[model samples]
Target chain A: MHYIEVQKKDFNVGYEYQQLVKDNSSDGAVVFFVGRMREFNQGQKVSALTLEHYPGMTEKLLAKIEAEAQERWPLEDSLIIHRYGRMEPGEQIVLVVTASAHRKAAFEACEFLIDWLKTKAPFWKSEETAEGTKWVEAKASDDQAADKWSEK
Target chain B: MITVLFFASLKEQLGCNGISLSGAGINTINDIKQSLIADKPDWSKWLHKPNLLCAKNCEVVNGDCSVTSGDEVAFFPPVTGG
Candidate 1:
């Protein structure tokens, strides 16, 4: 199953997360990754960040990745939440959770979901700094993380 | 005619997200993209870069692929974040 939201309100992702795992009673393991907005990027002090997405295409892309993870790793349930508009420092930007029959499938699939999402989903991050605003570019590490899975 | 769409940085640089162009000989998505870039040299940054990809008819499309009239051709940067 799939759950997705892109909004400005603060989210109780924990409850929604538990619901995903609970809905699939057979699931034995649940794994999640929360992306937080940090205060710094490339030596620049960021007070806030704005995330923008291509609405329909963004949802479509994420759903596709979630489906791929399920097919590759036997995940029973999955939830993905991504926030848009302006977000302050330390705010939660995104969450990826997966539940499966075994710990390995849950963990690997959850990791794979986030990894692929980083490179394949159509969301852009821009920094709001005292100096000015600038869109964030993809990091080499992020590409490496996603590439490793495709290679395997 | 073909509707050529842009997104994010591509839109920012082009100052517009979309345009409708004459598509007489443009039987392929790549042809439409080439026509747009050829008309607006300023968009060279986006068209020539390897980071940019084309979406034909709402799906990621290869550069060599063809498209019929009225197809929507979207150009996007390499995706980042979930």
Candidate 2:
């Protein structure tokens, strides 16, 4: 099974995990990653974050990324859920889960999914701070992380 | 007509969400951008950003990619999602 979602509301991680593992006994390893809104960034205290995305393109690119992951790994299942709109600090922002028969495949695939999502998915973030609302800049570190995968 | 859309800071900077332009004499994504810049010279600053991204009909494409009537084109900055 492969699931991808772009939603405005919060998701229940436990429920999503159960959905990924239910009746799937073949996979011995499961890896999941959760990304959260941070309270501070760039030496400033962030009070809120507003996520924006290209409605039609966001879903298309996410599904493409998930498909690419499946092709590269011997995977049993995977799930990706990302949220948008205004969210406070500590709120859940994204989830990625991968299940495979071996720990290596599960772990690597989960990391690859996130790396690609960070740079390829068309979601932008605007953070609210003490001074004013500011758009979050894309980090060079993120580009480097994603680039490493293509080198392999 | 072709529909052009902008997002994120580019949208805020351009001060417009989307607009429709005549497909006549426009051959590629670059043409669409040039036309936009021509109409609102002030938009050149945002639209011409070095890392600006473009998409056609929901797929990423280069400025030289061919476009025609009824296609949805998008312009935005580099992605910051995770």
Candidate 3:
């Protein structure tokens, strides 16, 4: 099973995890990750962040990324829930869950999913800082992180 | 006509979200860019950025990709989502 969601409303991680594991006894290992908004970025104090995305394209690319992960690993199930719109510091921004019969596949696939989503997804962030609002730039480190997966 | 869309900072920089252009001579994504720059000389800097990304009908594509009437083309910067 695979699920992909892009919405403005926040998601409940516990509820999503239960849904992922429900009636699925075959998978022995499950791994999940949650990304949150932080208060500081690039040495500036950020009060809130507004996320914007290409509506139709965002969902399509996310599905493609999840399918790519399934092709590369023996995944029993996976879930990707990413939130957009205005959010305050410490709020959950994204969630990734992966389940497999073995720990290695579960762990690696979970990491791979998030890594690819970071660079491939069509979402941009603008931060509201003490000084003013600023658009977040794509980090080279993030591109490098996503690129590493292609080598393996 | 073809629809040209811009996202995030590009939209703000261009002060426009989308526009429609007659498909007459618009053959490729680059052609659209050229047309846009011709109309608004100030947009050349942002539209011609080296790292600017392009997509056709919601799928990322090269700027040289073929385009035709009724296609939706998008231009944006590198993604920063996770």
Candidate 4:
């Protein structure tokens, strides 16, 4: 099974982990990633963050990223859950789970999914800092990370 | 008509989220940008910034991307989410 979701409500990490593991008994490895809002970014002290996305495009691009992961790995299933709207520091913002028969495929796929999502996804973030609200800018390091996957 | 969307800093700078451009003579994303700049000369400074990113429909694309009558094209700053 493959699933993708973009929601404003918080999700349960344990429950999602169970859902990815329940039916796929044959898969011996399950790798998951959870991203949380940080209190400090780019020398600013962030108290909260508000996330925005292109409504129709966000879901479409997420599904495309998931499909790419499945094609690159020998996997049993994969899942992606990303949240939008206002979130405080330490709150969860994203989750990715990859289930595969072997450890290597699960590990690589999970990393690849997050790396691609960072640069490819349409989500934008604005942080409430000590000075004021500031829009987050994309970093060159992220693009470099995603570029590594294209290498032979 | 072609729908244009703005996001993040671009939305704040543009002072609007979206606009509909009649497809009469426009054929590409760059054409839409030129029309918008022509209407509001004040926007020329940022509208043509080298770092600005765009998308055709929901896919990330370049300024030369073609557009149809009903396509939803987006203009925004580089993606910052993970």
Cand. 2 TM to true fold = 0.98
Q: Per-residue lDDT tens digits of candidate 1, residues A14-123?
A: 68866775546787888888889889888989999888777677778888888788778887788888878888988988888888888999899888888888988888
The parts of candidate 4 lying over 4 Å away from their true place are none
Q: Give Cα distance to truth, residue A47, candidate 2, Å.
A: 0.1
Q: For every model shown, what is its TM-score relative to the native structure?
A: 0.91, 0.98, 0.98, 0.97
Kindly indicate the candidate among 3 and 4 with the higher TM-score.
3
RMSD of 1: 1.9
Going through the candidates in the order shown, the clash numbers are 0, 0, 0, 0
Q: Which is the leading candidate under lDDT?
A: 3
Residue pairs in candidate 1 whose N, alpha carbon or C atoms collide under 3 angstroms: none
- After superposition of all CA atoms, the RMSD between model 3 and the true structure is 0.8
Q: CA lDDT, every prediction?
A: 0.81, 0.92, 0.93, 0.90
Q: Going through the candidates in order, state the TM-score of chain A alone for each one.
A: 0.92, 0.98, 0.98, 0.97
Candidate 1 lDDT score relative to the true structure: 0.81
Candidate numbers, best DockQ first, in rank order: 2, 3, 4, 1
Off by over 4 Å in 2: none
Writing each residue's lDDT as its tens digit, candidate 3 over B12-33 gives 9999999999988889999999
TM-score of chain A of 4: 0.97
Question: TM-score of B chain for each model?
Answer: 0.88, 0.96, 0.97, 0.94
Candidate 1: residue B23 lDDT (0-100): 80
User: What C-alpha root-mean-square deviation, in Å, does candidate 2 show against the real structure?
Assistant: 0.8
